[model samples]
Target: MSTEEKNPIIKIYMLGRFALEYDGEIILEDEGKIHKVWSLLGYLLANHSRKLGSQELPELLCADERSGDPAKVVKNLAYRLRCLLSDSGLPKETYIVQSGGSYSWNERLNYTIDTDEFLASYKRARQGGIDEQTAIDCYLQAISIYQGKFLPHAVYDQWAAHSTTYYHRLFTDSIISLYRLLEKKETYELMLPVCEKAIGIDAYDEDIYRIYIHCLTKMGRHKEALLSYETITNRLYDEMGVNPSGELRSLYREIMKTLKSVETDLIIIKEDLNEGGQAECCYFCEYQIFKDIYRFIARRVNRTGESIFIMLCTLTDKEDEIPSKKYLAEAMESLKVSIGKTLRKGDLFSRYSHSQFVVMLPDISYENGYMVGKRIQAAYKKNKVSKVVTMHYKLQPLDPKHF
Candidate 1:
């Protein structure tokens, strides 16, 4: 359309998947009868936010063609599409108007795309902050509007590619935002599946890995969580030729300590268990217990890699959970003797969950990882099932190249 055209009117154009108006009107320009005309119009309307030259219009419409008078064909199709737009209630100033050799859609057409509405809602939600439930509601509403790939079946056109890129970004940002919001509340169980879906689309994205790590940690899947860190490390190293970010490196080390503590606690529980009562630790209970420990570590770790040496001990028996404070104190005292000497001055010790004792170590390293392992080993030696407590270790190198 002509950029110089004045007094243009706004006409909403919906072209994706069953073109229907916001007011419930359907606009179906027989694709079978006017393929060339529709293609040119779709191209122009898709680029409605920008201006295009008349010469460029034909080339866009006849992109796959070898040798034909694309210029003349574009001119004729533009004329027909313009007429169609007018007949279809588009004001004279609304549809495409002729410029020099080029054409431009009427900028005055106050048409709104579904995606625009989605973006508006998403932004509002993000800026609303943590206490704003409405923001999360709006963000989710926007996400739901993304029913399918943007402008599906538009073929290999450049305009379609642009739509694809835009939608991909929107989806990714929405996922990241949603994850961040939910993370503050430690809603890992709720957000895990959503994070996985986003990872399925863009596995290279670091945010997805971070979300996964958070979820795994809260769920007390320490070993599995460590594997995720390793995966990210390997991916960053092998592909980006870089090391994990400082935050991630620190998180990895923290998970290592948590893993060790969890193993020791499991051993204590198993030794105390009469039989198969160990499996009574359901995912829900385990998740709750782990979340408490994670929150404790997350607070102490704050912004340093120093918080990786945290550990938690939890009772595996579900039925015999209730006990006196004195009994608990004795257990805590025994745990202190077993692991306390190995801890530093600022290391945190707390009774986090119903049957869990969490220990936070602010600073730890690869060279000392083995030492911590040995110290934990000694603590477990007094336990009945010390030998069965498998000592699993996965060390992450600090070098950027190793990720």
Candidate 2:
């Protein structure tokens, strides 16, 4: 089959990143430079229905240079852009045209633009007949096309930013509609994946979570449904400083009821009730909480005469340099486990950084505090993945009452 016959007339991709393909082959360009040629072409094609004023392109592209006339630069760039497109096995004027103090795509070429096609499919699906299944299929197609923000690499372009916001709203709306229709049909098998993808795209949407919870409940996956609800609420708490809605709380109460009745295994129920927190080490919380506790202890030590010691443990390579991020992360996790095993039941420890651990040994003498730090170092070293991973420590002993 011929190239033109076998492929899209011209394919323009602006999702995630930006690229163009005429027929089936990717159009090649400069080895490294970000050229204005293709970006302008994409803008024209994306806004194909509207005419862009001459000044708009210059302001979007060449606003920073401010050396000469931006309009002249736009004019020159337009000619170069036409030639560049023409070199891509297309006619000189097949895709771009200039008219009446404005520029736009020729609109004559048989072409498919990702954003346009997505929007068109979305509109038709919403306006189509009352067939829920067909609407869902169209929504899936649109969602799949939107891999990321519109023209993600071209952040400076105001038009691209505006288009991105518009498409994101459409994408979420489609998910909201599609999930409702699927839930109405009771297609839990297919609806689960749809809910997951929708969550992956927009984790904060309570509407998506509502349908997701319903699907999970239908499939008897109440545990996973509760976990997902907790995940979203934690995200909201940490990221948005908000709580889950009353509707979500009601759904969760029902899940709890189901779990209580469904789990007939007394052993499992017993484990869930009794298997929380360890006495080997004290509570771990946010770094700020750790610091606050330390300050409170510092204040009491003056009156209590309690020998308080703080230890800082850091991971280092055998060569005394910081390890790679992967190694660092693994070493830290291992160190955390080892610290938990080595600390006494009442001792407190918190991870202070990716490579640092802070521990409080209260009521211990200076020598015992030093020994505790050594014990942590020994435990951390035992779990090292390689000889390159090692531990270094600093211990501070404070007895404010005697000072």
Candidate 3:
């Protein structure tokens, strides 16, 4: 409640390397043993000007710490940061404000924030036009401005949602732009590295894998492309206990056929390339469709490190006895007929678990993934099942070499 601490000089502080001011002239830097809690404050402030309550601040700061009361640590850190800011001649009523149970920054303070400029420029560039080079330039600039992931050292905080979202947008946009440019130029070699980097940042992104697959095919690396299917297949099986989407499976088959040119020998030569096969568990019965799917993945994904695909499902509260064998059999028939009409010949679908199923497609990207999911959902809807069954789908692209 003291006037001295009422409105401490506010400065735009970036939470990277060490807490450093982006715009303050009389640079107030902390080099000696910087408390994790102090870093946590910088993490919260970096998000936006918000009233972080006293009760909430400590919890946010100490969320990852196992051995201390977050409340006490947060209070001490705030007091410590306040002294440092004041001693460094930070503007009065600028840096931070302490209210009853909260702490907030004065948003009106004048300061040159790299983050602000980066975001503004990025927004402007993207709004320019599709396939605009200016947008590409601004996106690179934004990537540079991102010192590190928002609050890299700050274990955890509830306010990190915004920063995470913005970071991903910038990253995804950059990758997609590069993909388009590379595709136009036919620079397969150059496109490979960029797509790799994007996948490293977000492995679950299907677009990255799709781009990789396309680039590989164009570059005449058909065998490698098929091998990649195995890697991604294993990953999805491990992480989500599911497989790639149906579009990808179709792509895989198409690529294989393209790789093996037809000969006039009148003899069908199957290239020993890895692939999913139809199961004979049920002859003439469509209920074996789900079984065929898992068997397909099991045959193909015989390696490791690609375990990020997951299948999550929730059953309707009422009439919940995981679909019986007969019901599943009926659903399989419906799915086979539905998918047969909607999907290409080679698409693969597997049972992820009791309530969920996965459709795997090797080279298909977002466009096909969306189409596949929508059609399948529609099929489930149009068919009159005995119970209220709902399925939600998520698609992930896996690292090809990981397997």
Candidate 4:
């Protein structure tokens, strides 16, 4: 403790990145090789509150390296770290303490860690009985410090899981607490970004979706709420093709119910595009909903003894030249209309990708499925949106497990 008094505090950041600052001066981070130094600092920071046994520290640090004495290697690393600290003008003894057969970051040193501050701020914010302003301030403080996960570099390391999970939960809790307080005052505009942030952090949390939907509803943005629900369903499906939960479905139903009152105006349209009564045919839905419907139909085929098949129609260029994006999008929309006219009323379909339309035809045998596919192809060919682009299709029987 002889020196380091001029700049007494060590500012170490551990929330998102591993950083060390003293007297507003950064260590050898901007220049060169300090990976081993970084690893040593991370381990000590991870187990900062208490000392790790000398043997255990070395073994943990050198878990992957074999053929050498871990203790000797760790001793050399420790000495190197001490020298680094000394060269940086910090009292080396105050930074790393070695005694009683253990090693730890010296508790007596004046240092601030982002992870520790995040926890403390969240704790202070949630200690009271939901004061909105104070809760907002505290949660913001915690969130401001959380640049990213506990240690982005060591994300897969087994040692990082516990703290990562803890910080993740704390972040979610902060959002919940702030929401609970904001809900009382009906401050949805303020809560909107918060919900979006939390969802960006953990999209798997359905409760946050509920709050987000509620916010949208309160703000009279019902369509965006539905879009958010679809966003969740789509993400869940993409990551793991799962259905929307009961809560989410119920929320969607409630929103639809709110929008249900049919307009009773003197209904006479000047454009009159629906002269053929809504152009008849398959039910169209979003890709995620279409996937769920496919699975639902698959589950019943075995018991009901009905044949169901799915088809994908994609747009391909007739020649070597690639079509522009505008033409591709125009072609997809035109193909959707053609398919809708060709398929039966009971069938289901969706736009599966940028230029692909997927259709599910139920209670149809292989022959009939082929007939339906041909009908769609013929219809699309008849009204060719692009002169050089054409429709290509693949059909297969219902495979429940595949869905």
How well does candidate 4 match the true structure in TM-score terms? 0.67
lDDT (Cα, tens digit) per residue for candidate 4, span 1-403: 1234654677777766666787786653412256566667678887888888977877666787883788888887888888877787554546778886688888667678888889889988978686668878898788777776777666665677888888988887777777777778888887788778777767777888988998898788888988998888766644443566778888887776674345545453433324456646578887666877777777777567677888988887777343455467567667888888888888889867556778988888889898888888887877656576788888998876643
Question: Where in model 2 is the C-alpha error above 4 Å?
Answer: 1-8, 28-35, 89-93, 199-210, 226-255, 260-268, 271-403
The lDDT per prediction is: 0.59, 0.73, 0.57, 0.75
How close is every model to the real structure, measured as TM-score? 0.44, 0.62, 0.48, 0.67
Local accuracy of candidate 1 as per-residue lDDT tens digits, 1-403: 2333343323233323524252345544333455666666666666777779755776677777764688877777777877777677544444676777878766555465566666677777777344556766776776666554555546455766877778768777777777677777777786676666666556667877887886798789988898887677655643444556667766776786677453557778777554455433212212334545556556545545442654455433224443344344344345445555555554445534433455544456656755664675567457643332322223332221221
Residue 359 displacement (Å), model 1: 35
Better of 2 and 4 by TM-score: 4
**Lowest lDDT 10-mer window, candidate 2?**
1-10
Q: Rank the candidates by TM-score, best first.
A: 4, 2, 3, 1
Model 2, 1-403: lDDT tens per residue?
A: 1234433576778766677776567775333254576677667877788889977888876866774888878777788877777776753445667886689886666667788778877887798564877788888888777766677656566667788788888887877777777778777777677678767767788888888887898888988988887777656543454567879877877776786556788898988776365444555544445776888887798777678888888878877876666577677778878777877777778866556788888888878888877887777767637466888888887535433
Alpha-carbon runs more than 4 Å astray in model 1: 1-42, 48-56, 62-68, 75-112, 126-131, 147-163, 223-250, 260-403
Candidate 3, lDDT over the whole model? 0.57
